[model samples]
Target chain A: MIEFKAAAVTAPDSGVSILEPTTLTLTEERISIIGANGSGKSTLARLINGLVLPITGTVEVDGLDTVKQGAKVRRKVGYLFTDPTSQLIMPTAVEDVTLSLRRIIDDKSERTEAALTALEEIGLGGKGDVSVNALSGGQRQLLALAGVLAVTPEVIVADEPTTLLDLRWRAHVGALLRTLPLQVIEVTHDLDAASRAHRTIVIDSGAVAFDGDPAEAVKFYRDLMFGRPTRTADA
Target chain B: MISLLGIYRPGTTPLHKASAGLKSLMLLLTVIVTMMVDDPVTSVGIMCACLLLLVSTAPPAKATLRAMGIIMVVAVLTVSFQLWRGEVERAIDVAADLTAIAALALAISCSTPMESMLDLVSRMVRPFGRILPPETIGLMFALTLRAIPEAARIFIDARTAARARGLERDPRAVLIPGATRTVGFALQLGQALHARGIAEEAKPERTEKKPRRDRRSEKAAAKEHAAAQATADAETSETPLVTYSTTKPANDVAGPTTAPEGNTSAS
Candidate 1:
């Protein structure tokens, strides 16, 4: 479980609050956060993993304080970025996965074997040795996911992971994320995907505008973005 | 330039089979030998041998030729500069030596897979493990190989966007965006590293030597390391594999966005 106790983030330069003093506990297996481009949804997702530390209060993952036990919290919470190109640091697919395994597996050949197995599991078996640059955008995203999974992170916090993918890839990756057994908290603009989550949180102008059933949260997000009264869900 | 790096092809040729460390040493020796000799004939002979070795590996023809073309262009410029100075023999010697070294470097890169080369780099740095983490240094080298093509793509995209806006001739249009985007990409990469927690655990050990912790604390640290390793072993039993099935071939019709020379996939 991830907990935010009056946690809020402020922009370092301007001292403007990026997230309002928000206190919430995220325990659902599949939770989606939807908001406008700059509504602080990404900030909220990042707080779960200590990527963005709160200036006001504290954020904790499974009782481990994100600020104090940051490395440990980060180990438990894997982050997936919008663009896999930036996330993939190695030349080849297998090499990239092996890099993630470095902290876990010390033996060279055993690490390679684990990485290859990860690639196989992610449907990139034959392309393990291929240059990461050569893989299609979709495959690259999948490979990035594979690297994150190789660490066996307990929670996955994805920040608009499918934003750069096509419709087909978005659906494929979305379904894949939903099926994963671990807790997944995703920040996305895809309303349909947001609606599929077990719970949805809607952020509007750096505050949680709505938090409830997925369908209702999606409706609230739509109303807020389209400049309509957010009471449409109630109406 | 990106193609000049990380372009390895798997093969059974003697050069391919040679250990990356041996190949790297040979490359260094060949360059040193070439530099020690100012005779045009010997340099030319070395250059020919390097070319023979490179072609025997049968690397991608287009990419190899492109690299050779670049080497030839540089050689010509150097030779012409020497000729302009009324040093004809010096021109021949300098051009031949330059070609020989460049060809030899390319040959080594083509024959040795990048993973092996990275391993060789880490092994080389193992002696200085206290001061610098061998794994981190290896990661830095791998990141360089990975970033070159990405940087090239960013430049091309920036230029294309500038051209579409009728600002192709304006250097600032491309340079400004390219610089900012590269910085942004680098920041994202750092975040990725932190999130992945690759080297975070071992980071403090490098600094522990400077602080000179007490023997008891050192023992405690050793115990912590062992516990971490034990936890890692326990976790390895759970593969953490997330499997999925796709409907169609995942291959993109647009092919790789990078240049053909950048592919270098074992064929």
Candidate 2:
């Protein structure tokens, strides 16, 4: 479970709030955040992993405060970036996954085997030894996910993971994300994916414009994007 | 860069069978020997042997030639500069040693897997785990290997972006953005490593004199060393039991990246 206690982010240079003073508890099995560009969806998602620290207020994962207990919080929260090119740092796919397991499995052979297993589970069975640079966009993302899951984090905070993916890969990755047993908090533009989450939050201009039912959240996001034709600006 | 480093081609040649540690030690010895030699004739002979050994174990003609072609240009420039300085004897000596060492290094890199080398290094430093964890050391090597190709990619991307914006042939436009992106990549990598909790737990101790081995421990180590050498000698074979493709894979294929030369798979 993630809790935000009036947590907000302010740009150091501009002194503008990237995320408004907001309080919310995220405990759903799957929660989606949908919003326009620069609307603080990524900020909110990063807050879960302490990737984006709040200037004021507190953010906690379970009982661990992200600020004070960041290392401990990060251990329990895996972060997936929009680009796997930066995330998968090892020379090869299996080596990358093995990196996550190095602390867990001390023996080199054991770690390698475990990493290979993780890769296989992520639908990259024969690609364990492939160069990270050679992997297709979808494959690289899958490898990144495998690397993250190898550590077995309790919660995954994904920031627009499917933004750079193609249609087929988007669906493939979406299905995989949905089926994960652990809690998932995803920031994305895919309305279809956002609609299928247990709960969804819509951020508009750096504040949570709507939160609750997934369908309602999606509706609100669409309305905000295209505007509601039935209502006047005053309404 | 992928073309230069971590560019281990998969093969079951005799060089591939050599242990990374033994190969590394031999490479050290080769460099020391080459540097000590004053006679240009001896240096040339040794350099030729090194070149031949490299060719015998190397990949296809085209790729090896391409890599060597770049090296050749550098080698020629160095030799010419030395000659211009009125140091003909020094020129021959330096040029010969340089070619030999470079070939020897490439041979080592082309045959050994990166993981194998990293594992060997990590275990070599396991005794220093208290001051610096073996895992941390291993992670350092992994990061170094990852950084090479990543930096290359960043340069390519930055250059491409510059060209796209009609800034072709402008070194400042290409280099500044390339350097900035590379630095950004490095910073993000540090953050990623921290996020994964790879730092500060051990609170790395200050570098100091290595702990001396006790007399008893030294005797035991000698015994262990003898046993390991005997086993290695018995296992050594010139035959290539494992078949591998001479043709290169279009994509980075599964196999060892770089190994220290002479094919001994260290236990």
Candidate 3:
């Protein structure tokens, strides 16, 4: 379970508010966070993996404090970035996954075997030797996911993973994410994708505007976007 | 894409099985031997032999030639300068020597996996392990190898984006975003490393019973550890700005103006 105790984020240099003090307990298996660009939804997802440290209160994953026990917290939570190029740090797909298992499997040959297995599990079995730069965008995303899964993290926090993918790849990746046994907390702009989540949270202007059933959350987000012009101009 | 260093073309040649250390040593010997022999005929003969050896490895022909293109330019420049100085034998010797070394280096790099080379790096730095963590040094080497191609891709993408706006000639437009995106890439890589626990795992454990190195080594190790910590802190602190600026929409109703870099179509 992930818990945020009045956690808030502000720009370290500018001191501008990025996230308001918000408390949330994300225990659902599939939770979607939907909001406008820069609406703090990404900030919320980042907090779970300790990517963006909260300035106000504590954020914990399974009782491990994100600030104090960051490495441990990260071990339990894997993060998927919007860009796979930035996420994949190795030359080849297998090498990238082998890097994740470096600390786990000390034996070199055994580690390579395990990495190949992980790739096979992700449907990238024969492409292990392929350079990451050669793979298509969708394949690169899948390779990134394979790297994340190699660590065996209990929860996967994906931030707009499918946003860059084409329609077909978006469905392919979305279906893959849905089938994973691990808890998934995804932040996305796709309302239809948001509706598939068991629970959805709507963030707006650095705060949670609505949080509950997926359908109702989507309705609230849509209404909030459409109703904003009349309520507040130049915002 | 142009192939750069550390690009291993899988093959079953003897060069592929040779240890990186041995290959590096051989390369050094070849350089020294070639320099010792000033005869143009011998140098040309050695250069032909090296080219033959490289071909025996069966590397990707097109990528290897592209990688060697820069070396070819350098060799041409050196030969031209010598010829202009009215030294015919010297020009031939210089050209052959350059080709010989370049072919050997390319052969080794193409046949050997980067991980093995990194392992050699770690082993070479083992003597300084007391002052500097060998694993950390090896990790840095690996990251550097990975960054070159990534940086090239970033610059090309930035140029493409600039051309799309017909601003390709404007240095500011091309360079500013390129620099920012490179920095963002570094920060993201740092986060990925930290999240994967690689940063933590790179530091070797010390036992209380083990004898301490000298005071200078201890201080150096502490300094290295502190620098790594500062980098991690900076990554976390500076990451919010990247996220905010990239994801921020131009208009309140419209979505973000641009997607993240490298949003290539899958078709």
Of candidates 3 and 2, the better by DockQ: 3
Please tell me the interface RMSD, in Å, for model 1: 13.1
lDDT of 2 by residue, A1-235 (tens): 8999888888989989898888999899999999999898988988888777888778889988877777778789998888887787766787778878866787878988999999989999998756677789999899989988998999998888899999999999999999999999999999999999999998888888888889878777788888674222110
Tens-digit per-residue lDDT, A13-45, candidate 1: 998989998889889999999988899999999
TM-score of candidate 2 chain B vs. the reference:
0.64
Q: Name the lDDT of candidate 2.
A: 0.79
Misplaced by over 4 Å in model 1 are A232-235, B81-92, B204-267
The digit string of per-residue lDDT tens for model 2 on B78-99 reads 9999999999988898888888
State the DockQ, from 0 to 1, for candidate 3.
0.21
Output the TM-score of candidate 2: 0.76
Where model 2 places Cα greater than 4 Å from the true spot, the runs are A229-235, B9-19, B38-45, B48-63, B76-96, B116-138, B200-267
Q: Candidate 3 on B1-267: residue-level lDDT in tens?
A: 346544677778889888899999999999999999999999999999889879978877777888678778998999999999999999999999999998998888778776777778889999998887887788899899888877887899999999999998898888999999989889988987876667585543322232323455445545555565556767777543333323422222322234335642111
Kept native contacts, as fractions per model, are 0.49, 0.24, 0.39
What does candidate 1's lDDT look like per residue over B26-138, in tens digits? 88898788878888888888889988898878777777789889888998999999999999988988888888787778787778766677788889999999998887888
- Overall lDDT per candidate, in order of appearance: 0.82, 0.79, 0.83
Worst lDDT 10-window in candidate 2 chain B: B241-250
What level of docking quality does candidate 3 show? incorrect
